[model samples]
Target: MLRRLLGSPAAVSGHLHRSLSTHCVSTNLRRSLSTAASSSSHPPWAIIDYNTLVDDSPSSWAPGACFDPLQPPRVSRISAPPHLLRPRERPGPGTNLVQLLTGHVTAASADGHLLLTYYDIIAEGPRASWNQTADMEVERFICNPISGQLLRLPYVSGSRKRICYHRMGLLTQPGPGGARFAVADIVSQRERVIDRFLPELGRWDMVVGLPCQPTPEREMDMNQETVAFGGRLWWVDLTCGTISLDPFSYRPELRFVHLPTGSTLTSHIHTKSESAEERDEVAKYRRVGVSEGRLRYVQTSLHEPFVLSSYVLDEEASSWALEHQVELKQVLADGGHECKNRPPQIAVLDPMNAHVVYITLGEQEHVVAVNIYQDKVIGSAPLQNRYHYLLPCVLPPSLGSSQFPETGKKGDMEAIDVLVSCGRHYKG
Candidate 1:
């Protein structure tokens, strides 16, 4: 029947014309899908760059997943900057330059609020006189990228400085009224004390009497990603394990959960010997996250015959049970790439899919999503830089623009009150 329709000269001409029109439309559509493509059509989950942002276009500042399904994941150069209420003013006609570095996404709440610290530097007069005229101010705040609401946090208790240098985590606890928010600070390196800043209270409360260090010899170093899971804030060390405590508790006790045996650096590597650079290299291959309603850990072997392994935490046994282990040689081959001597860094685990993981491969740092269960590469994207720290934020249907409630108004008051008390005027 199909052949009969095309057998006639008139029918053949009509079909060819339609095919040509369809091809043109598809070509134009592909051309329009650039980095600034409409984000409403993309998935909610995105690998957000910690320090990158596009300040000109306020709407595009929210990180939206941008990658072509047919092509390897391509880096979108114009990333959504953290939407700010008070943008910096342009430099005057004189030799003046105001540079703003958005800094890094230090931590994130499971609900999607990001804890960011940035520096605003202004230099006036002339290029040569920058040393004398430059003024830099540090700003730390939490914001919901989806909602575009930001709240600058008050200074640490009794500190004259505007920014706190300690490791911080965004805390969210669901309550009968609503989810209460706060920031948890590991106040001391040698002690288990924490300073939690409650927006409602408008002050930082010092939390003490927590458990001591898990390993007295191995000092606690929490420079890795902080995970908010199971009603506690987990401070992870890629080389060792995690120490977690509930910020909401009046008298919270710290608990230690070590990485699965053979997964971490040897017990004898003291804090002094294991430098920050060494710890960072270790983190490139290993990651711990909450996926599929379970705390999971993933590690890619540093040696040849490279292996990618995953384990899930068994709270009952206080250990990680092996879930999946697959050699990368076959996986890379399937992805139309070759396995190199060095394994790809583990980018992120799919918060919604238990079997999917993203790994950055090659010097170009193409991000490839592989399904460990199937041992196949599902998707790939190229990143602008290999050093970008990705923070995964899964936005569920329930998440909306009004995620910030009346409590945000109180937070604003707290910010102003602190500035007044310190005799410092609010910059913005």
Candidate 2:
């Protein structure tokens, strides 16, 4: 009856086409059915069997049953080259040098060759009392580590005799062909002031006042470096709160942002120190840095198996979130480091990658790079140990002389003044 209704070949084709078009069957399903029917001539035994037969014997074993999916991934190890293992040399003229000063470290521009350093003088004269001095002179000068070029920062006219250099932050603004950089210095005398050095202006000008004044107790406890991130300068106060200032703002704007609670690393070791204050001070170790245009906070303990906790600023929430946590012992073991000394001190997070960090092991003479993302030590480089002080700074290649012009004869007087007044600040 169905054949009679279809009638001729044209009528059958029309009926098939109408069925397919009307969703009787999909085109792919029809094609697959036709192909399977055409290939069904072979015997079942002639077809190659690709599936493995289940082994039910007592001696037989299955590998998948023994596999553990919860196991941690293995870590990769990297080695430093022979040249990097040797003591670092002083950067020559026109070379990029990231100089680490007494109380501060530098973050150099990736495109610029020069590193900014300063000359400071701390003179101690007759004292009126044991804690107070009769006369103190503080002079500061900005200098280039590569060319030995010095530029005297104009002193705050009619300021107090005692002045302290609090912290410095360097920010580079990208321009058409090259970039321009600005330096913000926090100087404290009777009052704390923020001074900015504009490359175009060629002089230090007071920008704004600090939100909080520095007392002798808090002055010694400030972070060594002020980080430049999110178009502002940030300093971690002694209480681990972040203080920020906008240098480009028309009004003097300063904001204090409290870090999220429980973000700091705490130690469980009980010290035998007689003073309870000393024990409290030894309970926490913190470092503030910038990574990937965001502010980062790092905390670790002073003992072995030093566990590190890292956090990044959450801009939307205006808080910090714990990002990474790892043990220093595991990192050292993976790096083939067998030093019996104290655990390395985390210096700063890599600005280019948030997962990498720079650390300085005590008296090791080399800076180690650990990639927390991969759970390994990627590399190490010898640090330039001057005056037994090892300041590990990452220095990129210099751009050119046109970007950072040499300080010629006009800077001669400033260099002379720095040499004469800053002699006492340098310790042999």
What lDDT does each candidate get?
0.57, 0.41
TM-score of each: 0.74, 0.53
Cα lDDT tens digits, model 2, 1-428, are 11211121111000111000111112232122123223222111010000111222332221110000110111111111111111224345564332111111232332322223221212232211212322233234332222222343444443423243445566655665444556675565235567776655555568545554223222322333455667777755524466666665555455665555764223322224323334223322566766666777777756668888788878752678889888888787779764466766654466667887766565645567788878898877554331111122222223211123323333221331111111001111
Best lDDT among the predictions, by candidate number = 1
Model 1, poorest ten-residue lDDT window?
12-21
For model 1 the local lDDT of residue 93 reads: 62
Those runs of model 1 whose alpha carbons end farther than 4 Å from true positions after fitting are: 1-44, 54-99, 121-136, 158-162, 175-178, 212-217, 267-275, 407-428
What C-alpha lDDT does candidate 2 achieve relative to the native structure?
Answer: 0.41
Q: Using alpha carbons, what is the TM-score of model 2?
A: 0.53
List RMSD in Å for every model shown.
15.7, 30.3
Worst 10-residue lDDT window for candidate 2 reads 64-73
TM-score of 1: 0.74
Q: Which number leads on TM-score?
A: 1
